[model samples]
Target: MPQPTPDRDDQARLFREVVLVLGGVFAVQKTDDETIRRVAAGLERVYRRARQNQRSTTSSQALAPHPAIAGLLRITEAEGDEP
Candidate 1:
């Protein structure tokens, strides 16, 4: 099943949370443009790393087929049949 995508409200909420967290972490009461930019860069790095890890894990799992599928594959190979 296809997953539902986040709406603009969800995105806005996430942005607000990021800014709030960054401000708290940096000990700044107000978020400046430069600070927001820096925070955005850092967040992007973290997001990319997370996505990469997910992809790697998914690919590794895909490399290992179910036992039934593995058996069928083996049989097909033995019969010189293309799967």
Candidate 2:
């Protein structure tokens, strides 16, 4: 089995690699203004939640953690542009 990578740079690299492998066109696509702003807001919330999660000891490592995964997480959770 492959070892799980935990280093920040390594995780980022892995994330990029995974996205590249899985996302295709949307792996690096851009969206319109309102959609971009909403995504940015959701990302900001995720960052705040990440900070809080660090303080609170959240361990699931998944962005949303819980099954609900929330609207905020839904921003990042979009698999691709196509429905």
Measured over all alpha carbons after superposition, the RMSD of each candidate to the real structure, in angstroms, is 17.1, 11.1
- Residue pairs clashing, model 2: none
lDDT of 2 by residue, 1-83 (tens): 85644654564565457445534533356545676567556655655564344554565775545665476467766754448
Please provide, for model 1 over 1-83, each residue's C-alpha lDDT reduced to its tens digit, 9 standing for 90 to 100: 85535654565576578667767866656657787788688777655565444433334344676897699779868886654
Q: Name the lDDT value of residue 81 in candidate 2.
A: 48
Q: Which candidate leads in lDDT?
A: 1
Per-candidate Cα lDDT values, in order, are 0.65, 0.55
TM-score of each: 0.33, 0.32
- Give the Cα RMSD of candidate 1: 17.1
- Per-residue error for 6 in candidate 1, Å, reads 15
Q: Total backbone clashes of model 1?
A: 0
